[model samples]
Every structure is written in structure tokens, then in C-alpha cells.
Target: MIELKHVNKYYRNDEEELHVLKDINMSVEAGEMIAVMGPSGSGKSTLINTLGFIDTKFDGEYLFEGENLVTSSDDRLSKVRNQIVGFVFQNFSLIENNTVYENVELPLLYNGYGFHETKERVMDALVKVGIADKADKHPKQLSGGQQQRVAIARALINQPSFIIADEPTGALDTHTSTEIMELFRELNRKESATIFLVTHDPEVVPYCDRLISIRDGAIIEDRAVIHE
Candidate 1:
């Protein structure tokens, strides 16, 4: 569903330019769950941002479902991001004052869905993430796992074709992280949603179908995970 060809990214200051991603080339297929693993400063997150169209200041080609994002206009990129990509951040990125229901409903509202349809979609997403009952609760009232579930629900409400999860389970306990990863596995299996997970945890890597390891802005390893 997505491909990056010889992609490069850099950050520039008045003094010098630092290359953060060097000749990164990768492909992710539909219904595939892949992990991009690397330590801090390794450009894994930059790679994710590039794939999600969250970072557009890069060189080379990024093709999403056949369209070259590098050549696409800002308006087109924005539309694609809203309609095709869903993002989950390590921080949960929830609105503290909004209830879970409202939080999940924001995307639909932004996408111009009617009230009834928005309500239905939000509820369905919450149910899918196993958090339907907590719709009325605020983010602070929920546990870390529950809050992350809310974030996932928000990401899924749009039924996006691609889900970009950056350190999704970074703050959760081990058991909770396993639960979340299992949930992602189910989503990949049953819903056919392509997932690109950016994480540093080796335990989380086992849940993915493929592992792409990066170091110092370069991919050092890319391999499929074998299951017995």
C-alpha cells in the first residue's frame, strides 16, 4: 500500500545540515503489520512521519496507493492524511477535557460527517477497541491502557487504510503492552488494516509480521518474522 524509494530527510540550521534519513527504501503491503525499530536518533520516527505524510520536507518518492506524495499539493496531502491515514502517538495525544466519545468523534466531525453518522462511527470504533463503556469518561479518569485504547479508537474511527502508531505502548505496563499489540494483530487479521508501528521495544517486535531495523538513519535489517 505504500512505498518509499531512496528517500532522504535532513534538518538544517544556520551552521550546518544534519541528515536524519539516508536513502531509506521500503514497502508495506495491505493487511501487513510491520515494526520499524531503532534507538533514539536513529530516524525511525522520521521515517514514520514521512510515510504518514506528516513530514513532507524530504527528497525522493513516496507512493501511497499509487500516488506520488512528493509531487502532491499541500491540499491533496491534507486530504489524504485525513481520509487515508490514522496516527497514534506515544503520548496518547488526547484532549484532556473531552470525553472519550467526543475524542473519537473529532475526526468524523472534521471530515464533515453528520451528527448521527459521526455518533455511530465513534461508538463502533470504541466497541472495536473494547472501550465502548468508557465513552463518557474523560481521559484522566481512565488508566494508561484505557487512555491508549481511546487513542486507538480515535485512530480507527475513520476506518483508515493505513495506521501509523509511533511508540503506541511506550507508557503502558508489559501486560498492557501485550494486550495492545494483540489488539493490533487482530486489527491486521480481521480488518485488513495495514499498520506501521514505530517502537524501540523488542517484545513488541514479535507481534509484527515484518521487522525493519534502522540505525543512524539507515535500515540495517529487514526481515519477515517466522511463526511456528
Candidate 2:
């Protein structure tokens, strides 16, 4: 549901232009769990933002679910983003003051869901992420893994077609990371949530159906791998 062809992202700094991504070509289909692995400064996050419609000024074409992203308006892009792409970041970007249920309900609020519908969707998302019992808890009260699950619940509240995760397991220990990866796998396999994850952890690589390596702002390797 995502495609980038010859994509080039540039940043202008006084007298120099920094090229972050160069000639990036990628395609992600439905129900696929793809991991983007690379060293630091390999443009993994940049590519993820571009795919998620969070970044716009690039030199090539990006198509999402058959629509040309470059031609879409800002309003249209926002709509598409809200409806199609769910994002999970390395930091659990939840509001410290809000409860888990409230945090997960933010997206639905923006989508104009009624009170009853919002409660139902938010509760379902929390349950799906296995954190429904913590619905009343705040971010500071939860463990790293639980907080990440709340973030995942927020991401899933919209029932998005795809999820873009940037270092989903970065802030956790190995065991917690394993649990998070397993959750992602189940989401992909059972709920058909297409996931594009950016990670550097080799241990987490085996869980992905596709492994993509990036170096010097380009995709060095993109191949299907055996998943356990």
C-alpha cells in the first residue's frame, strides 16, 4: 500500500544542500511486516516520515494505495494520513497528564466519533494491545513496555490500514522488545495491519517477513526472509 520511486529528500543549509535520501525505491503491500534496518544516519526515519505523509518536499514520486501523493493537497494528505497510516515512535509520545484511555481516544476525537463510539473504539484498541486493564493509568505509572502498548493502542484506535513504527523496541529491554515484536506480528497476521518498522536490533529481524537494509540514503538490500 506504499510506494516510493527515485525519492530524493534534500535540506538546504545556507550554502549547501544536504541529501538525506537518494533514489529510494520501495513498495510495501498489504499484510506484510517489513523491517527497515540500517546504521545511524542511514535515512531510515526520513524514509519512514515520507512514507507516512509527514514529510512532503522530496524529488520523486510517492504513491499510497494507488493515489499519487505528490498531487494530493495538504488537507487531502492529512485525511489520508488520519485514515490510512498509524504511527508508533521510539518514545511513547503520550500526554503525561492523560489516562491511557484518553490518550488512545484522541485520534477518534479528531475523526469526529461520537462519545459512545469513541469509548468503544478506544477500549477495543487498548484491549487489542493487551492493556485494557491499565486504561485508567497514566504514562508515568506504567512500565516501558506498558507505555509502549498504550502508544500502540493510540496508533491502532483509528483502525488504520498500515502502521509505521520507528524504533518501536528501542527504549525497552530485550524481553520487553520481544513482547512488543510479538504483538506486532500478531497484529499483522491476525488483523492484517501492514507494518513498516525501522529498527537496528538484529534479534528483532527474524520476526519480519521482509528485511530492508539502507546505507548512504539508499536501499542496499530488500528481500523476503523466513519468519519464525
Candidate 3:
């Protein structure tokens, strides 16, 4: 459902140009779970932004369902980004003032769902992430794992075609990280949810179906992850 062909990104600084992504060629089918890993200054962030539809100024084509979405209008791209990608960040960007249900309900509201129509969808999302019982709780009252669960629930509430889990397990302890990864795997397997996981931890790679490594502003390796 997604393809990047000979894509390149450049940043201008004075009279010089900085190449961030060079000749990136990738295709992702629906229901695939992929992990991306890279060190600092490796251009992974640039690549992620490009794939997530936030960065459109590039040298090649970004095809979604066979159409070049990168060349679309800014307003169209913004709407498509909202409808096609859900983001889960490392910091668990939840509002401390909002209840779990409220946090999960925000996306539906943005998508034009009325308050009366959101309860079922919000509860289902919470249940999917195993946090339905904590719907009334606040972020400060929950553990880190639980907060992250809420974040994942919020991401899934929109039912976007792609979930961009940017270091989803980064803030948790080892045991909690394992639990969260297992949850993600279960969702991928049962729901056929397409996941694009960005993580630096090698331990997390085993849970993914494929891995792509980036270095020096280029894709150095892309291969399937064999689970044993």
C-alpha cells in the first residue's frame, strides 16, 4: 500500500546542500509489521517524517495505493496524514488533565464524531490495548506502562491504516517493555494492523516481521526478521 522510489531529501544551509535521504526505495504491504533502527545523525528521523507524510519536499515519488501522494496539495496531504497514520511517541504524549477515555476520544472528535457516538469506539480502543478498566483515571495516576497503553489506545482509536510507533517502549522497564511489545504483536497478528515501529533496542526487533537499518542518510540494510 506504500512505496518510495529513488527518494531523496535535501536541506539547504547557506550555499551548501545537506542530503538527508538518498535513493531510498521501499514498499510496504498491508498487514506488515516493520521496525526501523538507526543511530543519532543517521537521518532516521527525516525518513520517518517523509514516510509519515509530514515532509513532502523531496526528489522522488511517494506512492500510496499507486498514487503519488507527496505531490498532492498541502491541505489534502494534511487530511490524508490524519486519516492514514497514527503516531505513538516515546514520551506518551497524553494530557495529564484528561482522563483515559477523554484522551482516546480526542481523535474521533477531530475526525467529526459527536460526543454521543464516541463512547463505544473509545471503549473498544481502550479494551484493545487492555486499558478499558482505567478509562476514568488520569495520566498521573497510572504507571508508565499504563500511560503508554493509553497512548496506544488513543492511536488506535482513529483506526488509521498505519501506526507509527516511534519508540513506543522506550520509557518502560525491561519487563514492561516486553509486555508492551507482546501487546503490539498481538494487535498485529489479530487485527492485521500495519505497524511501523521505530526503536533502537535490539531486544524489540524480534517482535517485528521485518527490519530496516539506516546509516549515513541512506538505507544500509533491509531484511526480514526471523522469529524463533
lDDT of 3 by residue, 28-108 (tens): 999999999999888888999998998889999899899988878898888888888998999999999999999999988
Q: What is the TM-score ranking, best to worst?
A: 3, 1, 2
**True-structure lDDT of candidate 3:** 0.92
Candidate 1 residue pairs that clash? none
Local distance difference test scores for all models: 0.90, 0.90, 0.92
Which candidate would rank higher by lDDT, 2 or 3?
3
Ranking by lDDT: 3, 1, 2
23-87: candidate 2 lDDT, tens digit per residue: 99988888999989999999988888888888988998998777786578998889889988899
Q: Per-residue error at 161 for model 2, in Å?
A: 1.5
Which of 2 and 3 is the better model by TM-score? 3
All candidates: TM-score:
0.96, 0.96, 0.97
The predicted structure with the larger lDDT, 1 or 3, is 3
| Runs off by more than 4 Å, candidate 3 | none
Best by lDDT: 3
